[model samples]
Target: MKAMTFKAFAVVNEIDLNKIAIHCGIPKKFTWEEPLILKGAILESILGREINAGQMVLIFSFGSVVFINQTEPSETTILLKFIQRFEPDVEINNADRYTDDYKLHIHENESLELADEYVMVPEFEEFYPELISTVLAKSVALEKTEEQLGKIHDRLETMIDRLEKGKLRIGNKELARTTAKILRHEYNTLAYIMILDKPEITWSSSTASEFYDKMMEFFELSDRYKILKSKTEILYNIMDGFSTISHSIRGLFVEWVIVLLILFEIVLTLLQIAGLLP
Candidate 1:
C-alpha cells in the first residue's frame, strides 16, 4: 500500500545541464537518457526542510522537473527557485502542468501491472522511478507546447475574422513578427524539446519501451503533435495568401498611377500646340 505523488512542471525552454552538473560537482556525463537525480542531503539542503524522506527530484535537460513524493506546494516552489539559478529563464508559474498519484504494491502475489495510476508488482525495481519520471517530464513538456500552439491558433483565428470582413490591415512589421513567432515555436518544439522522440532507455529495455508507449498513448502525445504540425502548415499557407494579395494590390496601384501620368502628359501637349499653355 505504498504510494507516491508525481508533480511535473514545464518551467523553461531549455536547461543547461552541463553547467548545472559542473556547478554541482557531479563528475558523470549527463545525457538525455537520464536526469539529474537529487535526494537525501542535497535535496534537504536545497529544500531547507528536515523531513524529505522518500522524496526525489528529477531534472531533465528539456526544461521539465518531476518531483516524486514531494507533494507539498512549498517544497515544489523552493526547489524551482533552486533550479532558477542554473536556468534563469525558467517560468515558475507555468500554466501547463501535470500531477498524478500512483500506488505501488510490491511483494504481492499479483502480476506486474500498471493501471489507473496503480502498480502491482512482485518486486520493487530500481529503474521504476526513472521510468516514471521520464514519462512525467515529457508529458508536461508536451502540455506546455500544446498551450503555446493553442495561443497561436487563437491569433490566427483573429486574423481570419479580420480577413472575413475584408480588412487586411497587417503591415510588414506585423507580418514579420507573426512569421518569426510561428517559426520559433516550431524550432523550439523540434530542437529543444524533441517531444516526438522516445526516451533512450526504451531502445534497450523492452519493458521500458512498452511502458513508455502506453504512457505516451495515454497522454495522446503523438496525436497532439500531429495536430500541431497541421496547424502550423495552415498558418504558413494563410501568411502566404496574405503576402500575395498585398503584392497584387501594390502592383495594381502602380499601374493606375502610370496610366494617369500618361493621360496628363497628353493633355499638356495638346494645350501647348493650341497656344493655351506653355
Candidate 2:
C-alpha cells in the first residue's frame, strides 16, 4: 500500500467515564466526546509512522502509553486542532490521498500494535487493486519517462557535437525510431490523468475516479516526454538545415578566393608584358 503523511485531528466520542475513572490516573471529568487537539509532542511522537492513505487513524492512548491503528488514517476535528499547536508547514487542506500515500498516527497505548494490512470489505475487492495499480504504474511511468528523457537529452547533445565537428551520423536510426515509438506508448499511460475527465476510464468500471486524478496533477509536472519528442525532431531539422547552409557558404567562399587569385595573376602577367611594373 502507498503511504503518505498529512495533518489530522481526532476526538473520542461517548467515552465510558466510569471505566476510565477506575483504570486511569488522569481526571475522568472530561467525557469521551471532549475534543482534544492531536498535535505538539503527540504529533512528534508518531512522526514517520506509516498509515494507509485515506484511512482513519485509531488513536488509543491512555496515561503515558500510546497504541496506534494506522491502517485507516484519518482524523477528527479535535486531532487537527491539536496538531496545529506543533506548527506543521502545510495547513489542513483535506487533501486527496492517492495510492502509496501515508498519514501519521499518534496515541498513548505504550504497546506497539501496528496494523500491517487494511480493513477492507467485500465491496472493494476488485476496484481497489485496479485503481491502486493504475496510479502505481503512472508513478513508475513518470520515473521511467524522466530517465529516458535524460538519455535522449544526452543523445541530442552528442548529435549536436558531431554536427559541429563534421561527423553528423545517426548511430542506429532504426533503433532510435523503435525507441521513440515505445515512448509513444507512454502517451496512453500519461493520458491516465485525463481519464478522469473522460468517461472512457469509468465506462468499464465504477468509483467516481478521484484518487488517480489527484496524483495526476503532480504527475503532470514530471510529464514532458510527449512534448520532447516533437521538439527534438524540430531541433534536428533546424541543425540539419544550418549545417547545409554553412557547408554551401564555405564552398562558395573558397571558389570566390580561387577565382580572385587567378584573375590577379592574369592581370599581373599582362602588366609585366606591357611594362606597367618593374
Q: Report the number of the highest-lDDT candidate.
A: 1
Give the poorly placed runs of model 1, Cα more than 4 Å off.
28-34, 50-54, 94-107, 268-277
Per-residue lDDT over 1-278 for candidate 2, one digit per residue giving the tens place of the 0 to 100 score? 23323222212111233433343243445432221222333343344443333432322111111112233333333343333333342133531221233232333433322232222222323333333333333343344444545565566566567668986444445335534644553443244222233223445644525433444444453345356446556545644554565567677879999999999999999999999987
Q: Candidate 2 overall Cα lDDT vs. reference?
A: 0.39
Candidate 2 Cα outliers beyond 4 Å, as residue runs: 1-125, 165-201, 204-206, 221-278
Task: Report residue 160 deviation for candidate 1 (angstroms).
Answer: 1.5
lDDT against the true structure, each candidate? 0.75, 0.39
**Tens digits of per-residue lDDT for model 1, 1-278:** 36666767778867777777777677878876568888887777778877556888888987888888865778877888888998888777752354445455575676767676765667666667777777777767777777787787788788779889998666788778788888977876655666677777788888778767776676676787787788788888988987887777778889999999999999999999999997
Number of backbone clashes in candidate 2:
32
Query: Which residue window of length 10 is worst by lDDT in model 2?
Result: 58-67
